[model samples]
Every structure is written in C-alpha cells, then in structure tokens.
Target: MRSPKQDSAAFTQAPEAVFEAALGVLQNAGNMTLLAAHNGGRRLIARERPKMSNAKFLDIRVEGDAGAAQLHVTVGTDPRTPKAMLDGKANAKVLKNYVASVRGAVDESSPAPASPVADHCLQKKTEVPWADAGQDPEIELDGNIRAAYGL
Candidate 1:
C-alpha cells in the first residue's frame, strides 16, 4: 500500500542514475533491504529491517526524459502488524529525514554526463567473426558420447 507521507524531487540527471543513487542512500541508511528494483521502469522497493520495533518500507519511483529526472518516495509501516500505529509526528519526521538523505546522496553521487568516449562506445557496434556468426552457439553432443562419458 502507498503511504500518504510522500516526497518528490527533480534533478538534472537520468532516471537510471537517480535510481542508483536512491539505492545507495537506502543502503547507507542501514537496515533497509532492497525488495525489488526495475531499472527499465526506474522504480525501487525497499523494506526496513523486519526485526526493528517500527517495521517500515519505502517505495521509490523515478521518471524523466533524457536531460532530467524526478524521484517520488513513499514511506509506510507494516499494515499487517497491529502494533504499527499511525503517528503523524513520527511519520512526518521519518519522511523528512528520508527525503533529505535521498536528496543529499543524489546530489553527491549522481552520474555525470557521458563523456565523448563513452558516447562513442555506446553508439559503436562490432561485427562477429564469420566462423562464429551463423552457428547455434551451443555445444551439441551425441547420446552415445554422453553415455560413454558417464551419463
């Protein structure tokens, strides 16, 4: 379930790069485990240490074009646990701290623009050797050979 407590920020970087920054921030936050990450979709889900008294989770979503990105973060507590109470003050503080940390980490570690060399590498294509080009690429063995080798 999505939390009502959410925050968002925009950056002058790619969505994928921002996603990586979010992962790093979560890791450094300690006790946060990445549950799911979709690089193509630019989304990440993480859970706080289950052992903690206040069990919580985070959902980070990224969207952007080639030049800019936006990150949305949602923080929520475990709905199944009856002990998890909704405290406005606590939730607000947690969300605030999380947003601040995420922003700081992204600003510090976001990937720089691709260099000319990197751009060239991304654009380049290589041709495979003719001998290996039209082959199955999988090794095939005869049943007799397998049996002889101890099938």
Candidate 2:
C-alpha cells in the first residue's frame, strides 16, 4: 500500500481565490478529475487515474478570510491498492508538482496595475560611464596595474 504525501502553503490572496486557482490548475493537468468540491471551494477532492498507471487521490483545503490564506494539500494512492501495483514515492512527487502548479496559478493572476517594485524593473537601466565611453574601467588612468593596486 502506498502511503499518503502531504504539503501546505501560504498565499496572499483569499482562501476562496487560492482554492479556485488550485482547482483550475488541477483541471488543466492531464488525467486528473474533480471528484468533489465542498465548503464553497474551501475543500476539494480530486483523482489522478492515468491509463495503466496507479490511481492517486488528491485533497486540498484552504483557510483564512480576506487577503490572506493557507492551503493544505495531500496526495496518495488508495490503501486497498496492492503493494505490487504501487509506484515508489510517486505520490510525493506528484504532490510536489501539484503544489508548484497551485503556487503558479495563485500568483499568476496579478492585480491590474503593476506594483512600484515591478514597475521599476520595467524601466530602462541607466548607462554606465565606462561602458558608454568604451573604456576599461578596471585599469588605472595610465594603464598601470601595480600603481592602481598599490602593489
């Protein structure tokens, strides 16, 4: 029997938002289906049943109110599934991928206006004096390395 794998993460968005994003990411993932969703997206259950592969289960739960949330996730093969049918640590790997996908999904939907920090990155960089003048700034004015280094 394969043991369950679990992980959790925190996000800046609301619980509902994070839950929905996770659900969407799972939906886009191949061979996964939504088994159920309850608590207005605060709790969800999904299954991964690939052809000729071990079936896996996923559970996601979200907590917190507005503007802040925590997401908990679990992945595992069915207990009844025989050991021979189990794939080693596949659940853990899948859980890691799921968490990464959910993180990307939650963070992808940015607010309309760019934050100041992000806007700063989009601005053109200032030119350096040495590069603009095509000069080797590392060398001394007279190209004397010993004098520059006080050697």
Report the number of the highest-lDDT candidate: 2
Question: Candidate 2 — which residues are off by over 4 angstroms?
Answer: 39-41, 84-88, 109-151
Question: Compared with the true structure, what per-residue lDDT tens digits does model 1 show for residues 8-68?
Answer: 8888988777777776776666577555455556665555654434556566788898799
lDDT of 2 by residue, 1-151 (tens): 2577789999999886787787677667778865545544366656687676577777778888898999998887754455543564788878888888888787784212211111010012221222211211222222333232221
Q: Backbone collision count in every prediction?
A: 0, 0
CA-lDDT, candidates in order? 0.55, 0.61
As for candidate 2, its clashing pairs are: none
